[model samples]
Target: MAESNIHTLVHKETITLFPVDYRISRHAIFLINRNNIDSPLPLLSEIMRSKGFKVTTDQEKADYIMRITSYVTMPTNKNDQALPYSAEFLLSMREKLPVIKPLLVQSGDSPGEQMKATAKLVHNSNQGILGSDASNIISLGSTFGGGAGGLIAGAAASVIDTTASIFSRNSIREGLAGFEFSMTKNSGFLNQVSGLNVYAASATPEKPEALLDAAIGRAAAEMERD
Candidate 1:
């Protein structure tokens, strides 16, 4: 009798979201790597908790998993110069239990005078519920869009959504939104990153408790069906 590797197999699901543009994505990756140099595990664990999901560093124990990545791309006019570069982001979700149906969301926008505009648009489009104080999270800068002036403008929120659907099996929905306001003298980094130089910042749910409840409800409903 063969060992029951099948029964031992811990069924799981995973989703990965990454930035679309090469330059911005690379820079964002650098920032994440740099900031998380001390301990990446904790960061991942926190993110999972925020989304109302359990985290196990061990891959074998994971029943469902999701990953998200984000990057910005320069928007070009006929002149081939930066106008309002579009921020391109991608998400991939995978599941092993029940079935799998991967989903994707792509969004672009002309940087607005206020980060809230862009943030709200992206967040709402991605089906993210915003907090009552969401407006305080984003800070828009003049050069946020794109221009000769290379500066780290205001601050923006980073929202990534990767959760299973309550109504359908093997279905997934994901989204991400952020804005930056401020000016930095790191022209070299901006030039090296390529594409639009978008600022990236960490985010906390405006109403964490509400979001958690929603996430739990959805997850429980899905589990019941399974």
Candidate 2:
């Protein structure tokens, strides 16, 4: 089939996709560089092994070389205590997709890019969940009166609701949330390819493991499905 670049947004789901007609079985030797605490190579390695790929430590001897390009893009200052600019970073990512996208169209089998493999991960966290108070405002306005003032108040409340929802509903849920993974590959020669998938879920700071488990579980499911 023609080269493909796919982006999927899933809630509480980790998506794993192979080439259009390919399954997760050709991974004979696989390796991903573990560079940080947030790195998930071990989790993925387990899944890959289950699908028949042998994990290798010697990169020069392996056929699949996985590189993680994951990073935290917000709250550069650990003490900033404010919400990191996730929305801004996402906007920037959207802009850069055109340049970064071409690299992800290739599959692990051919990796048309003829380049090595790399995956980009973007993560961010905030104090806690942010919820909209517009509905509460509407309720208060309605309870107060019923004449022109009520009509005017209702209209104003509706507008407020819409605006507030826009900011509160941008998918940046509270407490340790991560959003996307853009996988790019180079053939180490000429052509290149990549695949992108967006995953959504958040866990409380005190329950970080919950998020990790959720991701691993979703990944396994996606691997099986695709």
Judging by TM-score against the true structure, name the best candidate: 2
Q: How well does candidate 2 score on lDDT at residue 154? A: 28
What are the Cα lDDT values of the candidates?
A: 0.23, 0.29
Q: Write the per-residue lDDT of candidate 1 for residues 1-226, one digit (tens) a residue.
A: 0221100011122221222332221121111211122323343234335544454554444432222222121222222221121121111110111111111112362212222333333333333333211222211221322342222332332310111111121111211122221112232343222111122211221121222223223332333333
Backbone collision count in every prediction? 28, 21
Highest lDDT model number = 2
Please give the distance, in angstroms, between residue 44's alpha carbon in candidate 2 and its true position after superposition: 6.4
Backbone-clash count (model 2): 21
The TM-score of candidate 1 is 0.22
- Model 2 alpha-carbon drift over 4 Å, by segment: 1-18, 28-54, 69-174, 177-188, 202-206
User: Candidates' TM-scores?
Assistant: 0.22, 0.35
Off by over 4 Å in 1: 1-54, 60-64, 68-208
